[model samples]
Target: MIIRENSMLSRRHLLSLLAAGTAMGGAAGLTTGVAHAQAAIPDITLGDPSAPVTVVEYASYTCPHCAEFHSDTFKDFKAEYIDTGKVHFIYREVFFDRYGLWAAMIARCAGPENYFGIADLIYAGQGDWARQGDPAAVADSLKRIGLQAGLSQGQVDACLQDAAMAEGLYGWYQENATRDGVRSTPSFLINGDMHSGNMNLSQIGQLVDEASS
Candidate 1:
C-alpha cells in the first residue's frame, strides 16, 4: 500500500495507537542485544490486565497485512474477547525500517490510554501516512492530529525525540522477534505459541477458546 502525503495519520494518531504501556509505572530501560540468552521472554500484554488469556502481537506499522488485520479482524476480536475481559491483548512493535521505528516512537508517545485508539487511526490511514516522501513533514502532520487527542506540540516533539525510549523499544522488539522467529508482520503469541500474519476472526477466536479451556 502506498502511504501518501495527504494521509490523515497525524503524530497524535500514531502516538495514541502506538504508545500503550511505555508510560505506565516507571521507565524501564531494556538492555540492548539481549536475546533469549540474556533474559527471559518478557510478557508483553494489553486489555484487562488480569484477563485469563493473554494475546501478544508483534507488528510493524508499515505492514499492509497488519493493517488488514487491524481493520478487519481486530474489532470483532476486541468485542468478543478483549472487551468481555476474556483476553488481554498486548502489542509490540516489530520495526523493519527507520520509518517503522519512527512510527512506533510516535505511538509510544501517546502512552497506553490512547495507544489503541491512535493505532486504529494509524492502521486505518496507513496508505496515506506511510507513503509520504518526507517523514518529517508526515511527523508534523501527525503532531497536529495528536493535539486533537489532547497532546501539546511540545509533548509530542519531546516524545518523538526520546532517543533512549526509542532505542530501548527497538532492543525489546529485536530480541522478541528474534526469539519468536517472526519473519513477517502481524505475528501473534497466543498463550506462548507463535502465529504469523493476520488471521480471520474465527481462527483467532478458536485460539482464544483454546486458551480459555
Candidate 2:
C-alpha cells in the first residue's frame, strides 16, 4: 500500500475510533488528545547503537510481505548482524489501516524493553490476528498477543485507549515516511539509502558488507 495516500487520524476522533472496537476504552482520565504537535514517539531499536551500519525498516503489521520478511529473513539478519554488533537496527511502524495502528499500539504498550518481542509475536501471527474480520475481533487478537508477550490486562487496556500516544504515533509515521520517501511496506533505509521490497539474507548481507566497506 502507498504511504502518502492515507489521511491522518485526527485527535478529535481518536477516542471514538478506539471505543468503536479499535481499543478497549474506559481508560480513566487518559489524555483527551495530542498533548502537542511534537509528542515523544518511541523509536524501537535493536543491536549496538554505535554499529557501523544502521538499518531502518518501515513496515506495516498487516502487510503479508512484511510478515514474510519477519518470519523468514529477520531472524538470520538479527543473528548474523544485529547480535554480532555489525549493524544497528531500528523498526518504524507504517500504518496502512487502523488495524496496523492498533497492532503497533499493543507492541508499544509493552514498552521498548518488550516492544520487539511483542512485535515479533504480532508479525508471526499476522495471518490470524490481522484477518479476524471485524475491528473488535482483530482488536481482541492483538490484545491476546500483548498478553502472550507478558503485558498485563490493565496495561493492554490503558495502552490501546491512549489517545495522545496514538496521535503522536500517527504524526511521527507521516513525517518519517514522507521524509524517507517510503511508498510501500517492508521498505528499508540502509545507511540512509532506501531499498524497497523483501530481500534474502544473503542479499541483505551483501548490502551490509558494502555499507561496512
Candidate 3:
C-alpha cells in the first residue's frame, strides 16, 4: 500500500488510535514541517556500516509474514551475517495500518540501542498484540511491550503523543517505499535490487553472497 505525500496524518487520528493506555492529554500540535520532520527521523541500522553486502528490508510490524521472518529466519541470518559484520542490514518499517505505525513508534521509543530488541519482542508477540481487540486494546498491548523492553511509561506515552514525529514517520515511509518501489511487506533491497515476501536464510544468503561478488 503506497501512502501518498498529500495524505497527512492528523493529530486527532493519532491520539484516538493510541488513547487506550496512554496520556495523550498532553499531545502537542504538529508544528514541525513534513520535510523537517522526515529529516529528523533516523534510520536505525545494524551490522558493519562498510560490510560487503548491504541489505535493506522493508517490513510492516503488523504483517504475519514479517513476524514469521523475524522469528524463524532473522536469528540465523543475524548470526551468520549481521553479528559477524558480513552484512550491513537495514530494517525499515512499512506502515500498512495505524497498528503497524503504532508498533514502529513503540519500538523506536526504545531508542537505537534497544530498537532491534524491542522490534523482536513486537514480532514475537504479533499474534497477540496485533489482534488484541480494538485500536485501544492494541495500543495497550504495545504499551506493555514497550514496558517489557525497559522503556518508562512516560517515555512511551511521550513518543506516541509526538504529533510531529508521527507525521514525520508517515512522510518518511511514504517517500522511501514509493522511491524503492516497495508494494508489499517483507520486501528487500539487496544491493539495490528489490526482492519481496518472506525469505529464508538460504535465499537471503544467496542474494547477499551474490551482492558481495
Cα RMSD of all models vs. native, in order, equals 9.4, 2.8, 4.1
Clashing pairs in 2: none
Instruction: Kindly list the per-residue Cα lDDT of model 3 for residues 67-162, writing each as its tens digit.
Output: 989999999999999999899999998776678888898999978988999999999999998986576677778889999999999887767666
Pitting candidate 2 against candidate 3, the one with the higher lDDT is 2
Candidate 2: segments with Cα more than 4 A from true spot: 1-16, 19-23, 26-31, 34-38
Candidates 1 and 2: which is better by TM-score?
2
- Deviation of model 2 at 152, angstroms: 1.2
For model 3, state the Cα shift of residue 164 in Å: 1.0
Lowest summed lDDT across 10 adjacent residues in model 2 is found at: 21-30
- Residue 33, candidate 1: Cα error in Å is 18
Selected candidate, larger lDDT, 1 vs 2: 2
TM-score of the candidate numbered 1? 0.75
What are the TM-scores, per candidate, against the unseen true structure? Answer: 0.75, 0.88, 0.85
Question: What is the C-alpha local distance difference test score of candidate 3?
Answer: 0.79
Clashes of 1: 17
What lDDT does each candidate get?
0.68, 0.82, 0.79
